[model samples]
Target chain A: MKQFTVHTGTGVPLRRGNVDTDQIIPVRFLTHSSRTGHADALFADWRDDPSFVLNRPEHRGATILVAGTEFGTGSSREYAVWALQDYGFRCVIAPRFGDIFRENALMNGLLALVLPAAVVERLWDLVEDDPRVPITVDLERLRVRCAGVDEPFSLDEEIRARLLSGLDPVMETLGHHEEISDYERRRRPTLPTTTALLDGPLPA
Target chain B: MGSTLAQKIWEAHRVRRGGADDDLIYIDLHLIHEVNSPQAFAGLQARGLTVRRPDLTIATEDHNTPTIAVDRLIQDPAARRQTELLRENCARHGIPLFRLGDPRQGIVHVIGPELGLTRPGMTIVCCDSHTTTQGAFGSLALGIGTSQVEHVLATQTLVMRRMKDMSVTVTGELAEGVTAKDLVLALIAQIGTAGGQGHVVEYRGPAIRALSMESRMTLCNMTIEAGSRAGIVAPDDTTFAYMKDRPHMPQGAAWDGEVAYWRTLRSDDDATFDRETVIDGSRLTPYVSWGTNPGQSVPIEGSVPSPADFADPQERAAAEEALTYMDLKPGTPMRDISVDTVFLGSCTNSRIEDLRAAAEVLDGRRIADGVHMIIVPGSAEVRRQAVAEELDRVFTAAGADFRAAAGCSMCAALNEDRLRPGQRAASTSNRNFEGRQGKGSRTHLVSPAVAAATAVAGRLTAPSDL
Candidate 1:
């Protein structure tokens, strides 16, 4: 996990809605066992088109991605966010995001910012006009600042805490292992136990 | 206040209620497969953690296994290593695995309910996104990432955020030749793909109750395409009857006790939902997709939608893009679209009933010229049953390939079974996303009956056409 605060960098535009996880990183590239270095896999399908913004040399090092509404709309593959982060992007601005993708992005320290459709359009227009203009996404203040325009954004309190503190959810949830075990014990007498199922203690 | 069934399940499984945000819910069942389980086990090993409940954890080799030559060795080395890794990891963690040659081995979602591991009023989690398919048993099933999989494996607990409730009530009986697949596809087209985001859709009504257990599974299976993590139907007499005498189901007095508890898992009469929608099942026809996404669909009798049909500019652009990619004209009738292949296996529609439905259409008839059709059973049990019923012979005699090896063959394109570039297919799978079946492969999602009929016609057709 990586701590996320305020990130300032040049932005690029992906002016397409419903950019699904399949387009982010197709299943063909998922064969590797390691999690890192997926940046080369980002948007493999679209990168072949020379006109695609990410293929341009000017947008090579952009850290902010301005996409259309409903970005990351298919599959719960966490690799989508991993690919984006490995490509040097820190935040994605969209009108809406898929629920599972949003959760995966937050857990992986890739900030997904939801802004109004009008604000997102403005950001895209600004970035397209001046490809080198730096956009500052301040998570501390819940605002996105670019080209003299500052817009407010909000995140769920729990997700905010995790991003700011670099919290590992698996570690945080393990603290309640005792309670989970206690519940399992209580369920043993009443519910169907896996032991009974495997050993034929419960009749067929 | 009265509570919905989802609320009731949440309250029962909640170990602790966190402030204003989320709750810690105890998981009853955790299923894993080869593609998603290896990295999770790696995470566990890194932390020096053992599986909290080995008995509750289940693994199967499905996504990466070949659909032919079950007795022969796996040809793909990378896929073979993944299966080997899963076997090694499960053995190392003391977890039971249904290996490739095992009779119980199949798709994780299929085998879970088939083995009676999925029960009413439980919380299930898996690393694969289609884990929501288990909600057919009236459980709150969810798909999690690798990190969450590691979390569940270590602690058997998940920190879950509460989702809004949406009730979809279907009234009226389904017309003949209209299957659950059609019903669900119609709903997705109406609501679009993102309709169920941040909500748990509860399917209820006369039509839903009339479906068989397998039909219910079909309805629940594709709910993920609607962007929902969970979709459920309260347990009823139909559910109880389906669970009776299963190998893992409780027996004697325990059975009666479980049924009594399951009966109380329904939503209260006065319960309210955050949103509500209604569908008249009697009017729906066989549906098929014309474009890349699942939501880009039309009824068999309708024509491809023009961009002018869309009110949203983004939607209009997407329609244009889909047309260009699909190489389809806006005015072309859906039934006029021909296919090069017909696929008949996926988590959505590979059960015994689905096979029988396709067999009925293929019985005593040859597939159209230049068309290749393949039928893969849902599991070894389904294959055995189909063989006993002579459905395999029916498919083979009809000039179709009857494959016995079971897994997600063309659905994920992770194995030897895949569509070649520039191929067109009428498939019984859920997704038709760009290159889902294979790169440059065009897919039109259809029901098993429709898929079989399309095989016989070399074009999209409903069973009525037969």
Candidate 2:
């Protein structure tokens, strides 16, 4: 995982609210084993519409996505976060995000910053006014610097630490292997082990 | 202080509490499938780690396998490769896998419960969002991403954040023609798709308790559509009876002991939740989605909502976009909406009960002209039961396709079954998101009963409408 810190980039205003995982990267794109090459399929359906802002030349090479509330609203597919990252977005600013999507984004080193809806609206306006204007998302400072507003944001402390240290949670979790084993042993012995269960025909 | 069902389960599974933010919860079971596991296995290999609890983890082929032509090779190279990777990874890791041709092969959510792997007071995690379906057994089932899947594969533990509890009390009896699908749709429509975010919703009250175990699973499955990662219903006689005689469930004395434990899994009389809401089941009609999202819904007897009805600007804008995308007009009668296809299976409503419900409605009626209906069972077990009951002949006689394909068929459109562009469907699957069924395809979420009636009427209808 890449270490997330202060980064400045052009903002692409995805002004739609309740943008779901299906819209981010359709389920068809999820067929492959490899995670790369998702950028081509990002917003696959909407990109075909000439009026969609992401298709416009002005938003090309944008690294910051300013979206409305409830971004990544449906599905727990991490491909949504991967698609955004592969499409050159290092950070996404939204008033709110679906809980699972936020976790997935953070785990992938994609910064998900929550600001007030009013602040998000301002960022969208600023980006729309000048797509070339650099927007700074500072995970270290928990603030976004853009369009003359130094907006404060909040992220879960442990997630912030994980992002800063570039630590894979699996390693941290393994530290408690003894505890996990103990719990496993303490669980009721009545439950059948996966191996003990028959893969036979259903009972009558 | 009396503990709620969720709290009791959480306490039972907690390895340790990690400050104010998170807890170290041990997962009793971890499920994986083709689409999500390949990358997780690759991640493990890259880290030079083997699976920690192969005995507790299970894999199945879903999402990418062809529902039809099970005997033939998978036609899509990408899908086939993905499925093959799952086989290779599971083989190499010594994880138990129900492969494509296996009699036990099915959707991860369906097989887990049918095999009795999902029991009361357990904590379950899977890569698929609909994993919440297992929570109906009074387990703390949650959906995790690929990264978390790798975490569980390595440690079988998740650093979880405790969710606030929201009690959704459904009062009164379900009106005639209203199914669990209708109740859930009404909940989502009432609370909006994001309403259950940051909370674990426990379905309670007389109406919820009255539902069958299969129906409870249907309700729990759609909880994710409400932005909740998990949902639960307290274990009772219904859950225990359903688990009995399953191939995986414990036998004899162990079963009695487990049942005794499960009986204690309910909320106490004075247990309080962080939030509570009441839904009148008697007032719920057969609901259906009329827009690009699940929240954009109205009763079958209702009309398309005008954007002006929304107070939020963003909501109003979304409604406008949905109207345009769905090709619907304000005040248009929802029952008058016609469909080109009727899909009667998904994790949300593909169990035997759902199949029986649809078959009951389609026993003798023929699907209307130009309207094709397909019924895909949730699992091989369900398919076997449907065939034993001769539901296939009834469906085929009524011009509905009766494919006993045991994977996600039209739900995610990762398989051979998919909707064509500009086609409209009345589907039982969750998530009516744009392009969910297929590119340019419009989906109206409905129950199996409504789906069957719609197929015969060539329009959105309920048995009551008939």
Candidate 3:
């Protein structure tokens, strides 16, 4: 996995609460076996409309996605995170995020930042007014800062660790292969000797 | 500090805490499927490692298998390769498998409970998201990745951070025509899909207690929609009774001892949760999704909301986008939305009970002229039971297409069966994600009763409309 600091890019101000994984990357795209190439698949249907933020050229290379509350709601598909990352989004600022999506995103090195609703609204308005405005998401400090915001918001500690380390449950398990092997060997029972069975047979 | 059910389960299974952000917890059961297993097995092969606990792991094919002719599966070369790879992988590792032709073969979630493999207080992991459906049996079931699948096969454990607790209490009796599907849909709409995120939800109260095993499964199956790791219903007499005499259930004295343990699974009277939501079942009506997402739903009697009416600008934008994709006019009665197709089967609502509910509605009537209706059972056993009761005949007589059993047929379009582009379908599936059924296919999540009624009316309709 590649590691890079999150910096705000050109912004697209989307004011939609309860944006779900289905809307992020529809189920039709899920059938593909390859995990890559989902950037184009992000909001495929919605991007067709000229009014969508991503479709507008002014929001190009936006690494920060400013949105309403409860972003990334619905299915636990990690592809949604992949799509967002591939689409040049490094961090998502919302009032709240769906639990599984947040986990999946952070585990895969995507930053999902949750801030107060008022702060999110302010960021959305700033971006909507001028799509050229940029925000900076400092991974080291775990803070998201924009021009209009009074104070940078801190991300959850758990999410910060996941994003910085790129550690997933599977990678964590794989890291301890030796310890697990030792435990399995020590706990396993030995088979009885053939001599012991022969002695019992002779007695019988 | 207060602990959520996820935290409790995670802590209980902890083997060790590795560095910051690395908490290793033991896993009890590892369920495998065709789509995600091949690569994991290849990883194991490259490492020159073997499956450590063959007995604790199980494999089955669900995603790519066709519903028709059991013997003709090799027709699709790509699907054939996936199935062949799974067989080869399991064989090389000495792991047991339930292949397509096997009587035990079915949707992984369905087979787990039916075979008594899903038990109380056990941690279950699979590569499929809906694996949370197994939580209905009181297990800490959730989805994992292929690398995690290999890890569980090799180590029998996983690592994770803890979660918060959430209690959803449903008091009062459900009115007639309200089902578990309706309850879950209503819950998703009220809480807005992300409500239960980072929380382990425990369903409680009089209404939950009144639900049958099938109904309970339906309720738990959609927990993923709420972004929860799992949804659990405490094991009660009803739970024990449901498991009694099953082929793999404990017998006699063992059964008694198990029941004693299960009795302690419920929350104590003084137990508290981080979050609590109460719903009066009496007020809930038959529910359906009006937009692309499960949370964008309303009661059958309600009309689509005008985007301008939304207080939140974001919400208004979402409504506008949803209306555009759904080809629905804002402020119109949701009941007026016409449907060209009706599908009544999925892990969410494809049990025998669900089939019977639809069959009862379609028994003496024919499907509307332009409506194309289909019924796909959840599993082979369900299909066998339906056939025994002649439910298939009922569906066929009503102009419905009755297909063989397959995973995510119309519910997910993982197989050959799918809606054509721009077509609208009323589905009993859990999610209504845009094109969830096919490219440009529109889905409206509904109860089995509503799906049946819609088939007859060629439009979105409630069971009462039948």
Highest-lDDT candidate: 2
Give the alpha carbon lDDT tens digit for every residue of B116-135 in model 3. Answer: 67777667888777888877
User: Which of the CAPRI classes, incorrect, acceptable, medium or high, describes model 1?
Assistant: acceptable
Instruction: Highest TM-score: give the candidate number.
Output: 2
lDDT string, candidate 1, B1-466, tens digits: 8999999999998987775778989988889888766777888888888998887898887887887857756677767777888889888877778777777778888888887888999999987778888888899998887777888899888888889899989999999999999999999999988888888889999999999989988998888888886889999988888888667677899899899889999999999999898999989999999988888988999999999999999899989888887889999989899999999998899999999999999988999999999888777777878898989889999999888688888998888788888899999998887778887789999999999999999999998987
Candidate 2 lDDT by residue in tens digits, B1-466: 7888999988988997786788889889999998977888999999899999898998888787777756767778988898889889988988889887777888999999988889988999999889999999999999988988998899888889888889999999998789999999899888988899988899999999899999999999999989986899999999999999888667789888888888999999899888898998988889999999888988888999999999989999999999999999999999889999999998999999999999899988899999999888888889999999998889999999888468898998988788988899999999888889988889999999999999999999998777
The DockQ of predicted model 1 stands at: 0.47
DockQ-based class of model 2: medium
Stretches of candidate 2 above 4 Å error?
Answer: A198-204
TM-scores for every candidate against the unseen true structure: 0.97, 0.98, 0.87
Model 2 lDDT tens row, A105-147: 8889999888899998998889889889999988899988987
Superpose all Cα atoms of candidate 3 onto the true structure and report the RMSD in Å to 1 decimal: 5.8
